[model samples]
Target: MEKLRIVFMGTPDFAVGILDTIYNSQFEIAAVITAPDKPAGRGQKVSVSAVKTYALEKNLPILQPTNLKNEEFLAELASYNANLQIVVAFRMLPEVVWKMPKLGTFNLHASLLPNYRGAAPINWAIINGETETGVTTFFIDDKIDTGAMILNKKIAIDSNENVGQLHDKLMHLGSETVIETLELIEKGNVTTTIQTENSELKTAYKLNKDNCKIDWTKSGIEIYNQIRGLCPYPAAWTYIKDGENEWNVKIYDSKYIEEAHTYSIGTIISGKKEMKIAVANGFIQIESLQFPGKNKMQIHELLNGTQISSEAFVK
Candidate 1:
C-alpha cells in the first residue's frame, strides 16, 4: 500500500482527541485545518480553537482559511499533497475542498448515520430519550451527512447520562473508529454503504432558546430527559418567580419522581437545602443550577445565598 498523507480538519475540543490519534498513527499528517483565531471575553483577548492549540503544541503545519472557497486558500490547501482528509467537529466543507484528496475525505459524526444528522447530535439524542446512540464515519458528499458510510460503532446510553458525559464517550469512540477506517482504506478492502431513508427519521437540528427552555407542563420523565440532554452546555432553563421578582434559572443536575400530586405544574417546592419543581405527574429535584447574573451553584448554595419565598414558582 502507498503511504497515506492525511490532512485533518476540526475545531472544538471534541475533535482534539481524534486529531491526536491520527498524529500518532502510522499515516503522515500533512497539515491541520482549523477555525481562525477570534477575540473573546470582556477584555477581547484573542482565543484560538482547541484543535489549533493542540496543533501548535505538536508543531504541526496549521491552516485557518477565512474563506474555504478563496482561490489562494484552495491553492495552498492543494499544495499539502495529502491523499486523505479527516474532518471532525469542523464547519461544513465545500465540494472543491472535500474532493481535493486522492483517497477522498471522510468525516466522523457523533451519532449513527441517517439519525441525528445535524449540528447538535449528542445533545439531541439524549433529549429525545434515546436508549442508544453511536458514532459513524462516512465519505463526504455534496449534501450534509448524506454520504456513503464507511464504518459505525454503537454504544448504549446510560439512563442518567448527560450531554457532557455522552460527548466524551463518543469522542473516544470516534478516535478508535477513525484509526480503523484508515486501516481499511489502506488495505483497499473497504466497502461503502449507501444510507437508507425513512419518513420517521430523527434529525438533530440546531438548538435554540425555544428548544432548550424547560416546559414543566410536560411529564417529569420527558423534562428529565430534556434537562440532562442539554446539561453543562446551553443548559435547560426556566424562570423562577415570586410575588416580587422573577429570575432566569438554568438547571444542570436533577432527578425526578413520578407520583400523584395536586400541586400545579411549575410550582417551586423548596426548603433551605432542597429545591424541586413540580412537573406533570411528578417533581424534579434540582441538584445544581445557575441564577441570572451569577455563577453555577448547588441547590443548597443558591438557597442560602438567595432566599426563596413560600410563594415562589416557575414560569
Candidate 2:
C-alpha cells in the first residue's frame, strides 16, 4: 500500500492517544484540525487543546477552525490533499468537510455503534449500570454515530468500574482499533456493517449540571452507579442543608451495602470516621467526597476536621 496522506481532527486527551499512534506510524499526517484555545480554570487563562499541543510538539501543521463550514477553513483543509480524515472526540463536522477527502472521513467512537451513539458514551454506559461496552470505527454520515461500522472491539465493564477507569480502557482500545481500520482502508479490504435498526436506542446525550445531581429516590444500586459514573469530573453532587446554609457535596468513590438500614431514604448517616447515606433499599458508604470551598478528601479525613450536623440531609 502507498503511504497515504492523512488529516487528523480531534480536540481532547482521548484523541491525543490516537494522534500519537498515527504520528509514530508510516502514514503521513498532513495537517491537524483542533478546537481553538479557550479561557479555562481559575483566572480564566487561555488553554490550548490537547490535540493542538501534541501537533505543535511534533511540528505538524495545525488548523484551529471556529467553524468547519467556513470557506477559508475548507479551502485551507483541501490544500492538505489528504486521502483520508480521522476524527476522535471532536465536534461534529459538516458534509463539506467530511467529504473533502478521497477515502471520505471516519470517526473513532468510544462506544459500539447503534448503541450509546451520542455525546457522552463512556459516562452514560457506566451511569446506566451496563456490564459491557466497546469502541467502534465508522464512516461519517449526516446523523451522529449513525454511519456504517468498519471495525469494533468489545471490552468488559467491571462491576466497580467508574467513568475514569472506563474512559482509559476505551481510549487505548480505540487507538488499536483505529490503526487496524486505517490499514484495512489502505489495502482496500475494509468491510462495512450497517448499524442494527431499533425503535428503542440508548442515547448518551451531553451531561449537564442538573443531570449530575444524585437522586436518592432511586434504588441503592442505581444511586451507586450514578455516583460512580460521574466521579472524578463533573462529579455527582447533592445539597446538604446545615441549619441556615446549604452546602454542596461532591460524592466520588462509593459502594452500596446490601445490609438493611433503619434510616430513612436521603438521610445522612455518619460514623466517627466515615459517612454513609441511606437509599431506598440499602446504604451507600461514601469513600471520598468534597464539600463546597473544600478540597477532595477521604471521608475519614473530612470527619476528623469537619463536624457534620446530625439533622443534615441530602437535598
Give the alpha-carbon lDDT of every model.
0.93, 0.90
Q: Write the per-residue lDDT of candidate 2 for residues 88-199, one digit (tens) a residue.
A: 9998889999988989899999997799988899999999999999999999999899999999999999999899999999988998998899899999898999999797
Q: Which residues of candidate 2, in runs, are more than 4 Å off?
A: none
TM-score of each: 0.98, 0.98
Please report the TM-score between candidate 1 and the true structure. 0.98
Off by over 4 Å in 1: none
Error of 2 at 131 (Å): 0.7
Judged by lDDT, which candidate is best? 1
lDDT tens string, model 1, 126-180? 9999999999999999989989999999999999999999999999999999999
Question: Can you give the lDDT of residue 184 in candidate 2?
Answer: 96
- For every model in order, what is the number of clashing pairs? 0, 0
| C-alpha positional error of residue 197 in candidate 1 after TM-score superposition, expressed in Å | 1.3
Clashing pairs in 1: none
lDDT of 1 at 102: 91
Candidate 1 lDDT for residue 6: 92
C-alpha-based local distance difference test score of model 1? 0.93
